[model samples]
Target chain A: MRAAIPTLFILVLMILAVSLLGVFGSPLLLRVVIGAMINLVVVIGLSIFIGNSGVLSFGHASFAAIGAYSAAWFTLPITMKKIFLPSLPAFVLSTQVGLAGGAAIGAVTAAITAAVIGVVIVRLSGIAASIATLAWLAIVHSVFSNAEALTKGTSSLVGLPIETNLFVATSAALLALVVAFVFRFSRYGLMLQASREDEAAALASGIPVRQLRLFAFVVSAAVVAIAGVLKGHFLGILAVGQFYLEFTFLSLAMLVLGGMRSLSGAVVGTFAVAAIGEILRILSSGFEIFGVEVIAMPGLREIGLAIMMLLILLVRPMGITNGRELTLPWKRKAANELPITNDQIG
Target chain B: MNFALQTAIDALSVGSIYALSALGIGLLFGIMRLINFAQSEFVTIGIYILMLSAGVWFPLAALAAICVVVVLALVVERMAFRPIRTADPATLLVTSFAVSYLLQYSLVLIFGARPIGLDILPELARPIVMGSVRVPRIDIATIGATIVLLSAFALFLRKTRIGIEMRAAAVDFRMARLLGIRANRVIAVAFAMSGLLAAVVAILFAARTGVAAPTIGLELALVGFVATVIGGMGSLVGAVFGGLAVGVVTVLLQAFLPPELRAYREAFVYIVVIAVLVLRPQGLFRGAAARERV
Candidate 1:
């Protein structure tokens, strides 16, 4: 499955599906598609570490926050920087790289932060590791909220280019999907998966489990940081609160609901949740059905989404696809159909 | 010296909340191997109930709130956890997150996002002057309540048959079941006791803050969860100690750090947490759950 066309086919199919909407869908509908694609990019990045390595992370949103803010600082015009962040260093005040250069800077910065955090966190396993990741999230949120001179606390950072469209978002998501698929099949990824399945066995086989986890952690951080760049650019503003609890849980839920293990799971989960959310959002906006106008209902979408997630967990704990990779009809068997052992995931 | 004493009392009161929540969480982890993120919702629900019944006699309202919380906790056990008791830890953790999401959003729908004000615990706000240092009565009351609850809890665990069984279950759940411990009964009791702990935290926290909101429990629960982790998961005493340590460290850092850096206090506190986790993964107190055989 790693080398086959099934994975590629799924990625291309999702791109085309979303791109079709880009071309013909109403402007509001197009915005929804682009937003979901950006979410797909983040969710896929998260899956590369969480799904393969079997570690749950509540901190990846912090990486996204870091990337968004870094891009804001680097790409916003020098004039805007002076108005928003006068305390920024002289060079930073004058610096103005475009989106690509800004994203690269953000990704590298996030990757470095991950390299440091992962060294300590990867040493722990199971629920302890999960909790530690949460601690990292809380720390990032507090720092970003209070670092007034640098981040402007909770005030929105306006003036970033608002140019993210369906095509750009689809391409970014496709790039993330390809990178995640390749990494999942890489030697280090396989070794890390082995460690996830049976740590003692992996250790016995002389696999450097911690190092493999660190590798995935850093790469995933860079990928998520790119999602942050797109998000900041798309929204035309940056706020630390935007990257906290809601984003973290929503992304994690998508990965969990879609299927945690396979690339298809990430795409399916993102789309499934996004679709359900869209339907509910429209319904909440006082839609007319069968010549009867239903009044708008506040907070119903969130409530509906939460109920749906819980129902899914109860019915199919392994998620919608049960961690199976997408297989084309031409393929003989979906690659890696090994039974998902209970104790395997960290 | 006055400042040190001031910080100590402040930390003790603050830590007492974390310790109480962590204690409930730690108890469940002992018997059920669950992190119970929704335990915080128990606190939020308790406070909301308390707020609604504010016109009632204080003692009666509190009693009613406690009962409601206990029933809710038991319901969560019966509805969500009992069915998937055999699932892997990962599934269980994710399920807990789902449960949390359900409770939190439901709360938002019921009670709007805005924080509602109430002077819930005016008595606890009175200053207790001593020589040169002044402390609020709530500080003393918080510490006193913690001591009484913990002492009562320790006695219950040590002196009762169910308590002994719970300890046995914590050490070796399978063996305890083999020895005739009723699994459902024991698990229900764990949830009930943890609910009691959460109610206490809610009462104290609401008394101090005088406001009620949907996400109230989330922040406190996170603090308590952190305390449980640092104290050594599954160790009751460790959870209490860990909670106090976190509170003390937070206040001390705030007091001593340069004013310019004070805003980043949580960031500094988490750094210490990461250091502690890296240095002692089993935590400061090693319990049955921490004892892994290679």
Candidate 2:
């Protein structure tokens, strides 16, 4: 558990910085930081499974979708539900819970969905497994977008209480960080990392690859689900498209940019991408920097970010941190303790 | 009988387009173990070229599109991929995704995100009536194009030295390299072939949809990726079969499911995909190349 200290300390400091920004920054900045925090939660959740198991998942956002919709189902006012989702089941129509209760419901729903779906998913590996997860995302998107009564189909489900303030988002991020950190050092995590390095060897050593992958899948899904609930509440609305391709790509890019093999990579990657994205967004709006007028072009932001990501990957293929956790210099080479190497980072 | 014929033709047309795209993905996967998500961008560029060169003679315009896309594919390989050619499969995939995003937004910058109609191949829109069934000419063209391409590709693989070398490289790159097969040349040839296939898909797709957009090829490439996976990665024949299966299932679901559930047709199709994977985790093909060494 002592190994967890440095990782937790670094994460806590990051969270404190965000909290300070929320307290002192302008409302617009507050909004940006809150959105970034939500995305951070999702990326952290993504790294837990993708980093540890070395599997690419394109479907984690589906759990986020599940969480958002279910949270909306449980929390939306009965009057609003009757107007927007008249065909919802009577139980859901009648249900109206507070934000915490709804988040619980959302997380549980996503966890159960993942547990059922992960059986087939964890059995496969490499690109095949990646494609399977993509298929699952499609399945979820199709169902959620088509289930008009439950999800309002393509329309936005509104009236979610805008209760996910900076405090809530920061707390959730902290929780995600703690959960991920704990899981990374757990037995299941170590086994999954072994399998990730060399599946045949890991299996030869009698590691339950499938089971560990399943556990990671479920755990990550729950974390992402919580982020989804946070996002829905933050936006005061839920839309199927919000949890689809764009969100998946953005979160995955952040994880890969930070480094996919370590918790610190996830956190640093999210902050870096979010900060760059914000600066790009501002520049795209025709900001004047250094007395040189930057022309307004909405498309330039995406292109610029994509180019940056490409350049970064070309320069540092393993990511910014290169899969190593950030540890204090004075604590280096403490012989008996885990040194937070790439192999032990996840 | 008429409805059955129409559905069959529809399925065939869609299946052909997907198969063409999947062949591109499978070819690259065969050589580099890289799933080129940017294949979609290649298709999109081809469509854009076709749209812009509308005033030119149709055959010449098509050739131009093919040439441009092939060149673009080669450039992308050298600039974006070749540098990190030895990276792990996941890293390779993420890089391709970045390239795809870059290409897509660049298209958006060139031609705004909004889709524009393309009037190329207007003649293919005409319908041919046969025994109480109306078959669109484009459907026939798509199916014919796919058949010709597949046969020609098979012949090339069987009869040519480069094709044989490509096959050997795909089967075992290290051993093939040790045996004097040039890795760079084989990989480049694979990218060129995939580019050619993407070009063909772009024309057919444009003719069918009558529109050009930055996102037109994204969905196509995604379907191709899924088909490549279900067909068994690195197995060319399996990719075709997978595309056919996905297309048929999609058409059948849209035709038969209740209107309320019809919108969930994609869900049903993917459910079948999951089922296929569970039954055969390696995919439908048991190719020696796809099997795990252990």
Candidate 3:
């Protein structure tokens, strides 16, 4: 509980800065920051599970899809449902649960899905588990794509109330950060990390690896699901494809590129990648340098970000933060001055 | 009988391509424990090369594609993979992704996102009609190429010096190195073999589809990865069997499922994958591939 201070402090400063930006900056900048904050929610959720357990899940986004769709299903106007999702069950089609209720539905749906899936997924480890999660993602996406009556098939599920403003997004980000911070320093987190470091040894010491991983999986799923709902309302639309690969890669890239093991890494990586991506998008939108204006490059933003991620990986494979939480000078110990090793970071 | 024949040919041709790609993935996973997601990029580059040289002699175009893919594969191994040789599986997987991301979008930068049509291997489009069934010549060629490649690969692994060293290394990397197997040489050869197979897979894909795009490799590689897992990660025979199994099962589902469920074909396929994993975590093969040590 005490160790949550650093995480809370950092988050407060970040939120304050964002609030100032919202007040003074352009709407586009505010939107970008809010978007980044929504992404921050998902990335922090990923950090909770992937960071602690050392499992590279390619399927967390499926849970996000579940959450986002739930939000849309519950919140979209009944009239819109009649137009777009007439096949929906009468109960779902008739009610507009509003944003808060829809977010609850989203959270519950994602948690239940994760809990059920977590039973089988936690039984496996390493690459097999990775593959299993991918299969999970494929199955979810397939259902979402084909289940027309429910998901509107591949068509965009629109008419979401634009309720996720900066205040909502920032508060959620701060809450997610605190939850992650507490979870990381908790008893289960220690046990999970022990298993991550050496499953055999952890088992020998009486750690229940499966149950621990399941706990982390469910918790992270719930957090990420909330992010998905936030994102759905933020964008004022929900599309199955949006929650699939783009956020999957973006969050994973941020997690790994920032430092997979550290909370600070998650914070830093999300901002770094999001900022770089935002800047690249502006550059690709074409800006005048000195005198002449360069024409916009259609795919330069993604290509440039990919190259930047590669270079960063090449330079710092451990990630930008190198797995250690950021510590202030007065509070930092001499041991912190020593080069941090892999075992010490997460 | 005609339906069976058509489905058999369909399954075999598609399965052969999956088998070839899976073999490439399996070979690298054998030694490095690295699931090279970038293998698909090699296939993409191969198709792109063939597309660019479509007006050239078919054999020349194939040669150039194979050479370019092989060089690119070797470069990926040396530059990205080699440095992370001893890293954890997650790091390796992520780095492979980075390499894949780089190669894939770089192609987008150079070639743009538009799909390019290749007229190379149009002869393979010719069909053979027998009684009530018609099969494309490319189907036969695909099956033939797979059999030839698998056989040749088996012979190389069994009889050739470098191939034996590769096998030895695959079984036990540190022991093989201590036994004087040049790790670098063997790994490079593995990349070369994977690249060569990717090139063939590329031509086959191009012949079948008549178009080349960046995402083609990703589409194929995901299936190949599944096939590799289904066959057992590092086993060659299992990869072939797994690929064929996936192809046959997939086509069978597509052919036989109710129309409403037909569009959910991928869902069914992945469901089966999950079921297989739950039942047999070691895959269909319990062979001597390096299991993650506890």
Candidate 4:
């Protein structure tokens, strides 16, 4: 019954999304939903590492960039693939493996990279780990931006088959949620959480602290890579800018704002921030305050959102929902009655 | 030999600017154990303020820019830091990043995406020649000014009551509180000092580059951060040395390496930083015990 609730919720949301797409049928809105769903997958993955582990991994977006580029290299049409690889493997070049193949390859590549780096990075603790990961992000971004032959430099990679429709994206998001739920309940997840709360104690308790962290980091990278693959297919183009510091900041904001510890919080945060960002962009384009345009205000949305984050931290530092899940009450409580636990009553 | 000399000189100039900006960053980290990601935004804010107020006297504009950044830093401390000071250090770090984005984007909205060139202070930007190599006068000024500012800062730290308070706070905030030192005030001052240093660095950076943009802060911050880690997290002297090392490495790579791979200068720098971090995580000069806080 406990497991069914989350699954049922995701199913309902997916159905609603499809229904909304059928009725409204707006391509732009569909596109936004697709992007949000893809982001949701990566955010859930990040929650497992950052939320449960109590560490920030700044390089997660770098994994996303790797996934996007790797998938694009494999799947984009030959004519549009001149920049990255002039000649590809016969299998990759000849066969137009669709979204699933691209995403899987992306996941594999990201996981491999993460495993290699995690061996070194997972040894470090606290801010050192954060700095190392941040450096990793910068290094990957530099490679993506400068490797003109492969990534076309800053130029966007086009000619990708748009295989990431709302359905695919919604399904990926649902899958991500399930994975997050399973991980949260699993013994490994409990061990990882214990390590996060007290590393010394966990180690004394026989937990392989470094190995656990590395495991979480690799899994997170793989999930983010899959998100990147979906994002590339949905957009039908990939650019370095999509996965750089700006995206990193946006994801961090979403994670922080939504309450990082819960799967539902990740979803709510992604959707809320995405919606707010869209509305802000629209306002900036059209709305003027006292003859001064709002969008012209430089970093208005970011500043406003940042201020909102500050306020949240000030008043309720734990976040909007304090890492709590939203659920329908299974047992009913009588009106005007105060329920008590047996221990308290005794 | 001439090429090497030129590269060294060029590196020194850039290194001086980095050192100036990094001093603030190092101090903030030393006292609060938090990396102020918005430190770069303070540089951007300073540059834009100078540009916006260029119609006034150049010195006055520079002064106003510094003052504005200091005030902004204080505001950030009060609104952002004060609230989250009790939260986990990771949360404080993320908050700082959010503040950085907010400041950068706000500047973009206000100033537009175009680069703002501050040509009003041409007198401060005149070039100086040394035998075969020509160096910008502003570069010389930046190096000289950094030396003067740092010397003065060292003196202040050695002599002043507030400086002692700041040192006490940095040594141990809890102990400082027990000793009746106002840790909050000291932290606020540290941020303002950092902002002031960022303003100075921005003016020099803009003078050399001829333009300032919103994105400049992030790149410079990365360099400063690399320098900070290389120098050791909380050591001001280490930051200065680290900045010089980074600048020299970049310039030497540009000068000595084949033309084709010059663009890989940043990557080379990253490798060096990572190598240094792996080998000596406490920094070359900082003691092993310094690793406990950062």
DockQ value for model 3: 0.48
Provide TM-scores for the models: 0.95, 0.96, 0.94, 0.90
Worst 10 residues of 4 chain A by lDDT: A337-346
Model 2: lDDT to the true structure: 0.88
Against the native complex, each candidate's DockQ, computed on alpha carbons, is: 0.49, 0.57, 0.48, 0.35
Model 4 DockQ vs. reference:
0.35
Q: Write model 1 residue lDDT over A1-346, tens digit each, in one string.
A: 4545676787679767877876898988988998999999899999989988888888899999998898889899898899999998899998899888888888999999999988888999866787789899989999999988888898988899886778888888988988988888777777888887888889999999888989999999999999999999999989889999879888988998888877788999999999999988988788889999888766667878877876777787778888777777656254564457764211
Candidate 4 local lDDT, residue A277:
69
Q: Residue-wise lDDT of candidate 2 within B66-147, one digit each (tens)?
A: 9999999999998998888876676678789889988999989889999999898788999988878999999999999999
Deviation (Å) of A61 in candidate 2: 0.8
Write the residue-wise lDDT of candidate 4 on A187-245 in tens digits: 78778877776777788999998888898898888889999999899878888999988
lDDT of the candidates, in the order given:
0.85, 0.88, 0.84, 0.76
- Report the lDDT of model 1 for residue B164: 89
Task: Assign candidate 3 its CAPRI class.
Answer: acceptable
Residue-by-residue lDDT tens digits, candidate 1, B94-194: 67777777787787777777888766667789888999999999999999999999999999999999998998887777778989999999999999999
Q: Where does candidate 4 chain B have its weakest 10-residue lDDT segment?
A: B285-294
